[model samples]
Target chain A: MANIKGAVVVNKERCKGCDLCVAACPCQVLALQPTEVNDKGYHYAFMQNPDACIGCASCGLVCPDGCITVYKVKL
Target chain B: MDINEIIKPENMVYTKPRLMNDNPMHYCPGCSHGVVHKLIAEVIDEMGIEEETIGIAPVGCAVFAYNYLDIDWIEAAHGRAPAIASAVKRLNPKKMVFTYQGDGDLAAIGTAETIHACNRGENIAIIFINNGIYGMTGGQMAPTTLEGMKTSTCPYGRNVALNGYPLRIAELVERVDGTCYVTRQSVHTPASIRKAKKAIRLAFENAMAGKGTSLVEIVSTCNSGWKMSPVKANKWMEENMFAKYPMGDLKNV
Candidate 1:
């Protein structure tokens, strides 16, 4: 079996920038933008290192705002 | 397929629950109530009971639960959610009724109604959020506050002599003979979130199966009220709160 890859779509507008998803990520793929803020003035989580994700969905699982959607691809 | 192509619905491993409305929640960043709300919406959608579920929104931070959830809801007076949920379940036997309450609402304001409804074996699920402080009203000491926890009301930590001990509401309700399922769970991490979601499913199932009362107490956190970041609040909960209100099933009959 080949390696599994993953991607995450963050609903920036709805994200409250709670940082739960950023901490829940196992691959260190997510982070809060230090200089950018959404319309709500919150620094929402974003996939800073998209290549490191392994489709674990850990970020999505712990997201309080339910703003992270996980997608997986099997090679 | 390219990673871009994997973003399609077929490759999606997880997304927001359908029952969760598109409205942005009003909860503060890292508020535990949002996770619980998401879990409830996921459970209701997975069970295919969106229309048959009626949520009783307690008068607290989660009073706007109806707006976030795409289901019917009833607003109850402060600490009166259990009584309202009992009536809703009794009147609509086929409906899956549940009350979303906070520590101040459940353990303090609605103590009598909660115990009596549970004692009477009302076929309704109760979702309790125990953050140990009144999050909505500016962080006042609640009935579930820890022994030495500081809040607006108890600025110098809770004094047992003046405020009495923190009530273990789950322990008290589990022994009431009316509750069929009683569990204390949290959503600080991925593993705990899954467990809490399962607990919610079980409680909802019990409510729909004509079983007795089921209470799922979520030992949550109020990052804004606690004066800590979301991550620090979760760590504090795991350290301070878990020792007092340990997670896992207190009673499952």
Candidate 2:
């Protein structure tokens, strides 16, 4: 089976929830959630699909806050 | 820490540096300057030039760029970012230098400084934020204000017979021989934001690599000055400003 493991990680405290990263991700793996607040009192977004991540790194490239990380798992 | 396992849409960790701190920016809510600021910070972070960089803030809405960008900064006297950047770089040739300016500051009163800096080919990065109106000074008519565009100074839509057409600063600067890289991008949406960041990073990288003066003109929105919502402001820029200042690389020498 064609498969990749691992997931994307985000630093909650630094995320501004701007959604720029969400918009840049091609796999629709990032989303700005209304749930959770960072230290700065801003509602930080959470990643939804870690396994679906292709590790293209576009999220990291476009995130204004540098709060996103994508990793590929070797099974 | 499964770092990757804990990954969800909201918890993704980005590799770009968050140079912009938590300080509240002085720009109005709907101002395009905020977007431009974010774009610049993102670019600086991606280029890894934040630590050894000095940025000059102009006298318009972009004057407070220092507050948003976490880097060594110097405030210029209204539209003189190029001049200040020129001096700062000349004094410390090893450091990367940049200037953030607006239409009112760059194309209007500071025209001479901008032209000469580019003409002299000072090795500096210039982030030109063009929103067309004099945002800080109560939405006054600026040199780049579009024809038939109403501003405080031109209450009844700019008249070409009176104010002439909008000044295309990017085109004018591209004609100068000293300017090695010049590109105009917009920051109205995510896709455009990506493009803007690429352009800005390239400008910074070019200067850091000892290239000649590099300029990135960002077509931004001035919601407060334009008397429109942030979303509408983006729309207005797409409809009006884009026609006046089409996005693309003007000169990449």
Candidate 3:
């Protein structure tokens, strides 16, 4: 299978740490980083495993705040 | 290749809808209102109707819906969105009009307005968000509260005998003579979100075509109101809520 790398950009300020994106990610590529807090004092979601993302946009789709953006590239 | 070069516009798959404002939403974390609001903005952007579109905001959690969408909006009295939207549509027949209402505002206090508007077949779209409980009022039991569902008001769980059965507004509206399209959807999953966006787009198109009243009920979740995590709330909604309010088209005339 061709390598399909994906990337996700999270607008940390906009994210309320709802973690809906973490649950919606099918590949388990997302996680709410506990160590880092954004300006909003929330532990926002991060792409813990970017290579595993399939660019499904599931995380972005379920996000209430429109905080996550997804991109893909064929390698 | 530079990382910046790879992150070009052509590589973008998904981003926030342009019609949505940059202001942070006041919705609770994991609240379905934000997702539904984004969908509405996307529909308006896709249809290029922002200029002619007028939204009627209800007096619920979505009362500030006007703040999120960059369009003309009128804050209607509680449950009076449909009545106001009807007037707007009648005065500006060429413009697109819609009402964003919650279960408490639509299925309860606005029940008569909702039914009469549909019965008259007003040329407007109604985006109904049915999260079962009244989230704005601290999760009180609503007209659409599921049987045996426990809310703040119904601490012992809703009893059909006293609270009455959960109103199936979509189905009821579908049966109305003037309704041209009616569908129940959700935004929990990607596929469901796509379907919902399609339904919303169709509702807008129907309104522009003057087909009749189009009602799209989004069976949503209230994680904070439900006293559960966002993830659990979605699962609970899928298992419990969907049973009473199945997702699909009730009518497409």
**Native contact fraction per model:** 0.88, 0.25, 0.81
Model 3 lDDT tens row, B1-253: 3335446678889989998989999999999999999999998888888899999999999999989989999999999999999999999999999999999999999999999999999999999999999999899999899999999999999999998999999989988899999999999988999999999999999999999999999999999889999889999999999999999999998
Best by TM-score: 1
Please tell me which model should have the higher DockQ, number 1 or number 2.
1
Off by over 4 Å in 3: B1-5
lDDT of 2 by residue, B68-97 (tens): 778999998977789889998999998999
Runs in model 2 with CA error above 4 Å?
A1-75, B1-17
TM-score: the better of candidates 1 and 2? 1
Candidate 1, position B184, lDDT: 97
In candidate 3 chain B, what residue range of length 10 has the lowest lDDT sum?
A: B1-10
TM-score, per-candidate, Cα-based: 0.98, 0.77, 0.97
Q: How many clashes (backbone N, Cα, C below 3 Å) per candidate?
A: 0, 22, 0
- Any idea what lDDT model 2 has? 0.78
What residue pairs clash in candidate 3, if any at all?
none
Q: Scoring each candidate complex against the real one, what DockQ results?
A: 0.86, 0.22, 0.78
